[model samples]
Target: MPERRPTRSLPETLRTLRALRTPADPGFWRSPVRGARFTAVLGVVLLVGLTLLFVTGLLSYAAYNPDLNPVNDKTPGKGWLGFYLFSWPTGPHWLYRLTQGLHVTVGIVLVPVLLAKLWSVIPRLFALPPARSVGHALERLSLLLLIGGALFQFVTGLLNIQLDYLFPGSFYTLHFYGAWVFLAGFVTHTVLKTPQAVRVLRQGIPRGEGGTRRGESGTPRGESGPPRRGTDTLAAPDPLPATLSRRGALAMVGAGSLLLLITSAGRSFDGPLRRIALLTPRGGTDPGPGPNAFQVNKTASAVRITPADTGENWRLTVRGPAGELRFSRAELLAMEQHSAELPIACVEGWSTSDQRWRGVRLADLAALAGYPDRPPGVFVESLQRGGSFRKAALRDNQVRDGRSLLALEVNGAPLSPDHGYPARIIVPAAPGVLNTKWVETLTFGEL
Candidate 1:
């Protein structure tokens, strides 16, 4: 009675397994381009890329800590309802600059790998359930979130970096919130799938190797190492696809990522790479008046303000606790001038090399305007009438720091019109928007 073990013929068993998959999903299983090896290859690339992006992105977020960031933001100061309680390091002035650059560059380059990974697994979307259990359902749900969240982060982030505001609503808040949701889904999926990925990879080429001979355990490694009861599925199908090989697919994804990294890296790259980064919009050799001459986000002509407005009669009017203190261009230049090297960073993630900026200190202006020696806050108003950031409020640190300036010159030359002309606010560790240009007024006090 114990000798009754039986099995199907070899060809019959192969036929049954071939028919075991789903009807609704695309048949990637049938394609030469799809298999565990190909899927695992692209998956590893995407996994690493996405992990880096998330870490760097969170670091960038920390850099904007209300206590550390010079911009007077309302949210972080309150500590996200007391949940996220951490401070960004104030050391290494270039830290945020480097992290954000890496975040954006990694994101752009990883696009190809993400797409290929999705393509390889598209059939699983249609796979008939091997079993209909709660665990299976949960895995599927996580997959949905992973795909959706990854696409959201990549699409929205790229558009923002390019300065294209086609999407409505606040990109900053939406993107930040989206990142948390994405990270949750990614962790869940990784936990459930990584063992299988590692096993498939360990089994060698698609044909399987070592202990994974014919009739070896089809069951995963951590499970009881038995030949999976009824399923003697081969450890692999075919090592190379009939059409595109795994090597070819990996090469394409890698090439795409490299191209993206080079073009979008901008002046954040130095050495010889900076010269060859053809897609970089921030240039060190550009002829203008701001740092590296100038890197114009929005030009004066585009904003439609006349040169006369910023010309000889231009005056910076400071309304303080005492009264209004006004200064003409020559008068500000005549004051004790201080110069500092500061990098102007944009929320879009591109940052300039620190430039030699010379001007009067903002704290000095506050003092001259009869405010307390160090006001807790400063409000900057630009001559440009209509723009979202025509006005900006500065944090306590920015107002107190001597490096903060009403800069009149860059390097040795006065600012060009596009570079904010007669003067512009230049502050340490502040967003470019807070450095309001075409100066008109300054008010130092409560926000």
Candidate 2:
């Protein structure tokens, strides 16, 4: 500065800045396990697990019937993203439960593998001469998206499961969009690197080559050579003594995944097995010792639904082409009563075991609304004062299902206030939210 040294150009300044960083020197990353073979094993596992996670996540969105718009659809301006969406089916009664459960459980289990995969290739992130060409620049950009998207998805998903709504905006919208972005980067990276990864896997880790010896740049002992390039970037230029072998590292990651699986999978089941899912939210708890004892996502108080609101004054409104008919809780109970054991599964990946639900069939209600033969879509509205899913629109398949009910009692007991006392909607294979509690109105129409 004293001599007014010539100002360096932007590119030159960036190069110098990169040179000073510890990561810029391959020797700074002294882990012997950071190599192509190690990375390939982790990558293959992620490729399979992440693919399943994505499909199941998309299926969960579809289960919400997002195409209904302003009703259950949270993501606005989805455009072509909704192209592949189909009318969510209403069969097997546990479809949504299984899909959403897999989505969440697999995502949680893959965390350790994802971390290991990143660790094996982190040196590539700080390679000198950041962009060797336009193609290289594109590669780096994709990598950035891949890492960022993955972290964002996992963090948001975990927060949702914990019922922590710290993030601004709707979780459904954010998660839906984030999934697409992650998929793009994932597809690109997979295409670009699959061949190399396959080749590395085919040729397993070399024997007796645990790591680059200390003070060596991946060259044979007694020889001084230039640092490695390309795929060899993961090889430390000047490594430290090996503390853990590559196979040992892989085994550790597998064990971690297995542990998470054991602790999370039980949330989808009932009885004694469910007690083992210590890591899952709402797991291992005895809600109470009674006929209606089970999980409840939101109590009447939590949703600002007061006792008076669901008292004798409350009436179920059924509207359609025929006419508008209203019924009191007693009137609904007087009508033909049906019973179905359906599990209530939530998007947060929690599910209650099948509970005995007794109520009038939705199809019967639709008939009162004039659509007796083929029940049109029904928009079920809740009496809750606040919260999303106050209203939800069910597709024709769901409404026509014999098991769909406007439930009056659960487990042979009149519903408690927290369990949607006056009335609630319970449909097989539908998400818990769609089973609108404290149901106020049912409008049958084309939509």
Candidate 3:
């Protein structure tokens, strides 16, 4: 502006701007370990790992029975994302436990591998001529989505595991929408790159050299010395002397995965094994010793549940087509008592081993509510004054299951105050929140 230089046309100005930002020099990247083979290996691992993560993640959402809407569904206006959702089954008892445990534990274990994979292909991110053609432009866009999506999903999932919610808006909605966006890019990238990756893995670099041969100008070359060009930006033309071999790098990544697995997998188990899950939130916690001693997501005090709130005056209200009825703690205990050994699994992926839970059957309560046979869906309410799941709705199958109970005791002892002293709903294969601790009311009907 001070010099009053000659004005340039829009095309010329755009070209000049592009040149200013372009990293056109091939010698810029100096990593010998960055190559087709290394990236391909890491890509294959993510292919399998990410597919499992996605499937299990969807299953976790479905297990919530979001069809109940407003009560269980956190992500409103999900549209097509809700297509795969179905009625969660109430069998095998440990279905949610196994699936969610794998989801979190595997995600933790893959962190190192994912990082290494990103590192291996970092050169591509800064490749000059951002888009050479229409197809290339689309490919670049997909790559951006893939990288960004991967980071967002992993970061949010880890924060969730740690019980941190620093991100704005509901975690459920953000994560669900983010997953779809990521999946779109992921599927596109996978389709386009799978063939090339497979070919590279099977064929190896030309002349079986683990590293690429560079020409004088720091450009990669094939056997005949032609400038090897295309989408393989990972080939660093002027690689530095290798400090770590490719195989050694892969071994290091695998070792990291193993360490994470060792430290995070134990959160799903009971007894001594649970102590080893130091990387997880509830891993190191000591709930003290007793029949009731086990992991708890929240204490009674944390939920603002006081002893006075669950005092003898507390009455469980049951409502149905016939009418309404009420019962005291003694009356519920006197009713035909049922017992079941079921594990309470949380969405965060922590769970307890099967504990002896004794209580009145939910179906029996439905009988007292008038729908004696084939109990319809029941909307259970908790005494908790405030929380996300103060009330939850159970599907008809869950209500009809003989194993489902309005639990009164645990491990042959009365439930502790923090463990829903007066009463709690305990259903097989149900999320821990649906167990509805400190239960106060049961409304039986179509929900």
Candidate 4:
């Protein structure tokens, strides 16, 4: 005979399960008094460090764009700490790229810390009634602006990186403009917080007891009742509830672990390493044979160069304002030689490995073309007849810029027909529009 086992009703089992699955509410984190100083110090250090990067980044951008800063192109390099600077126009330079990567990388660490700090201090938001006084209103307004700006920057920047859907130029312009706003708000917040924070530190303000009173009483009152007992009396409102604390702690651990992984990942997957390792070449990998692919040695009339076709015999002719014209492959090669390994930074916001360049310096070519005595602008035309000329009016400010080069080779090899063949202008740090390929003629301008 089989023995029968006892079974509970379905409703009882459901009730038991529901009781076991009940969740606890998560509150704020109330750090010990000593923790305030540590957190404050850490935050201040990070804030200062990041601010310096912003200042330096502005300087770098200004330096790179000599038209913006006509007098001097030499700005102090961001140096070892350059990683924090994340402004744009990042071209084929080691230091600039290094700084940009650092800015994004360290920001990952600061994100959570800032969030946690805000969480801990949120109770202060309700400490006073809104718009009670002018000073109070201003204080609250400033805090709102400061937090809003910070959140705006952090959120937008992350989104810009992850999602490719930002309205073109919006991110860059905002990033550029918002930087100053952030700086102003940040400075104001620091100045406002300094006194209270310093006072709290100096006095060793007791837990939840010190600081200015909310509303005061007129006269002294008699004892109300006996003080409450046990840890429960002094216990906080469980700033972080058990469930949230466990979850947050777990999350923090996970993030920290991820950060460690990212650090290693960055080492391999960032900068030169990641660019070289993970990213596979796209679209046109093999550009085909050199400038000789389409021979033009026999053609007397200059065949019109068009963007539609990158054929051989693609002769890049140069003409000056005063009707001075020059042609032939021998003349360009006879000029001075300059080379650099720079990345092609597209406005579409993606970058490639450092491209090796070999060509005559535009300045030198300009000098040879009768501009050495004085500075003058030049017009660059592509072989394609219908397309517009890539004209760059080099002013006195940009005359000495090293970034301007007429590249004749890529990766130590002669330029391919598809890649502007015989000679192409390689503007080192300039945007895509400025790096004129399939160059057919150079015309000097008085303006």
Candidate 5:
């Protein structure tokens, strides 16, 4: 159906492409805001966002193992090279809730800033004579790692939030190692570029040449002959017009960030904000019936636990330094009972509203077993096996903390099978899975 249009020879096509690439310098069409000041401002926002993301991400990973360094050892609690070394906080009881909430929230909000930063300097990739020297080449390498790693994190993370898994490999492992690699590149690039950034910022933005940044002598910047041996050219900013003025861009970015926070942060806040978090996955969908109508991460049918067996044959056990003790549902219900309002926060960035949980405190269970709190921690066992968080450890702080519970009922009704019938551990601030649904046993003195 096509008209016979001849294809050009490879050499001719290459020549055409090169000729097309020789358009006017970017300076002619761009507005003043597409200058160093704009980039510097966006870069600063990106820096703060990255710092928060890295810190919180490390904390979330360490939370997987309470005894690990990232969880048990690090700063804010102390000063060990500014790394997270202290055991994840137990006193506040909602420490994981806060850190993880910030982690996802910041990552989502920083998307715009990241995009702006990339748009500001991508032209340098195409500048004539791609690499001026070996040092410049190295800087380009680091920049490549930084951009690639950051984009990878953002895409994978957002997909994870939606519970989507398209790529092969463990998300946790990939993201974990990727964070380290990204940090390495970020530090190297920052070290290489800071002086130029500072100089351009001081000179006032939108310099003379088209997107030409302050760089080594001999480039479009300073002297214009041969670049001096020790120096390299600065990154040229993009030529996007300030249709949105510099201040306007920042404001739009802040507004977008705030909007995302208010809507998505419902996954953490669990208060009045829950009603307004219209975009959150947990909001509209039916959790069927459970605590505050809580959403179930793993259904009974999915885990192959039958409703009949869960109700009639279930028993709870606690093993500690003293000994092992077992109890039926009625026996547990008959004991000194307490209730609290707590949230079920998931690593997938979805959380339930405050559930009115009625249960026995973990400390009481350990006392019943004759074990007092000590170092190391307790190993919690779940009835259903074959899932990644079916078992989790509770450090001394968590076990001793009165907020931790082996819950029996929620919202005045016994727990539904889908919501861990008979018994489940509901700890303060622990990831939803680490709370160990359908709990079976508690063994103290485990690493």
Candidate 6:
């Protein structure tokens, strides 16, 4: 017998298999526009999640006090969340930590998404519709502001991580103010887009004879075919004379662009940058660490000065109502020394680890300065001089806050000059603005 011929009908076989496949099919799903939008939206959501976490975490972290946790007793088992939700459980430390972690993780995801989304949507930017007069200009202005702010965040955030060497202080100032600008644009975009979004959803997708095109090519409701490649082909022009009617494919694009701007504004910064200036490099003039970075002064600072060659001599001067008290580096080192672990939280919303610091208590040092029972103020000067002074008003409450220390050592090592050598004040929960460094003068009474 002749070899039995394979009797499979290839077209029929393929058709049968395709018929078995659904949009819900588990395998090799494909849709380009929807996929890109989905990715874009995902990026927005992650960004938003990060923002929520950071803001919430910061509020919680500021309020948290680890001392409250009951160390002696064994509490019933629950993970960190349960601890945060129930008992004293270390206040919001765990919550802040978890959210901060999420914020960072999402930030990492955003790098690629930021590039992809911008590449995908940038063509649409230059193709914006023409506006009429000042009102139109304002609307466009709002959109521009939104776009600019978004771009600022994305760019600064990335730069912060990679290029700390180039721009050190830039991150400190711009990152703070840019957040507000972004928020304003976001709110405006959402307000403007709300009605259009509702209209689009209400009308739903249009279909007709011969797999007819709907709103636009490659859109969810506009057109559908094998997913278009790089650029989805534009739909055929409307047969109806162009009226000002918003019931067309162009309206959909407008709504989407609006939505993108709104969503991005509201949530894009939610990730790591929000928590710790994500793109910002670590370990600079004021690099953020947490409570663990604390330690006591160990070096015999005949005078503890760093960068030891700036033509600046180390000096310690104490002036107050009781009278001017001055000390050479030798005099400060002669004073009684003590050590404690403390936390230093900065206003930029980052902190040193549980830092073990050794130094004289500010209270003790104040007494040495012969302060009144309640001296009015203190001033710390850096060795570099030229109008660098941290003037602190020493109220009764500050005097009593035992956590305040004239730190001479950090993390079990003598203070590095970058960290304010010789001595600096470590005040828990105070911002970097308040944590005085290179203490050359302590002036009490009015400032």
What lDDT tens digits, residue by residue, belong to model 2 across residues 275-340? 898888878774777877788878889899997898879999999998899999999999999999
Best by TM-score: 3
Can you write out model 4's per-residue Cα lDDT over 138-192, one digit (the tens) per residue?
A: 7678777677777766776666645454644556556655666676778777775
lDDT of 3 by residue, 1-447 (tens): 388777999999998876563345556777788888998999999999988888888998888899984799898699888998889999989889889888888889899999999998776666656666687778788887888998899999889878889877787887888888889999988876776577679976533222344222222233212243333456677689999898988999999999988887888877888888777777855488897898786778888998888998999999999798999999999999999999878888888889899999999999989998999999989888877888899999999999999999999999987788899988888888888899988999989
Estimate TM-scores for all models: 0.77, 0.89, 0.89, 0.59, 0.80, 0.51
Question: What is the Cα-based lDDT of residue 339 in candidate 3?
Answer: 96
Candidate 2: worst 10 consecutive residues by lDDT?
216-225
For model 4 the local lDDT of residue 148 reads 76
Each candidate structure's count of clashing pairs: 0, 0, 0, 10, 10, 30
Which lDDT tens digits does candidate 6 get at residues 1-447? Answer: 899877669998897788674423322232223222333343455356436633543343323221223211122222242234322122232333344334433444454544544443443344324444566567668867676876676566556545442434545346545545666776675555433333334443222222223433322232222343322222111123434332333344445544433333222132232333323323222234442233211222323344653223666777665677666655666778777665544322333445677777777767666763553334555553432123433333344356667788776777766567777776654434445667667665543
* Candidate 6 colliding pairs, count: 30
Ranking by TM-score: 3, 2, 5, 1, 4, 6
Evaluate model 5: give its lDDT. 0.69
Q: Where is model 1 more than 4 Å wrong at Cα?
A: 1-28, 59-91, 198-244, 267-275, 280-292, 370-375
In order, the Cα lDDT scores of the candidates are 0.69, 0.84, 0.84, 0.49, 0.69, 0.46
Task: Look at candidate 5 and give me any clashing residue pairs.
Answer: 72-86, 72-87, 73-84, 73-85, 73-86, 74-84, 74-85, 74-86, 218-224, 218-225
Best first by lDDT, ranked: 2, 3, 1, 5, 4, 6
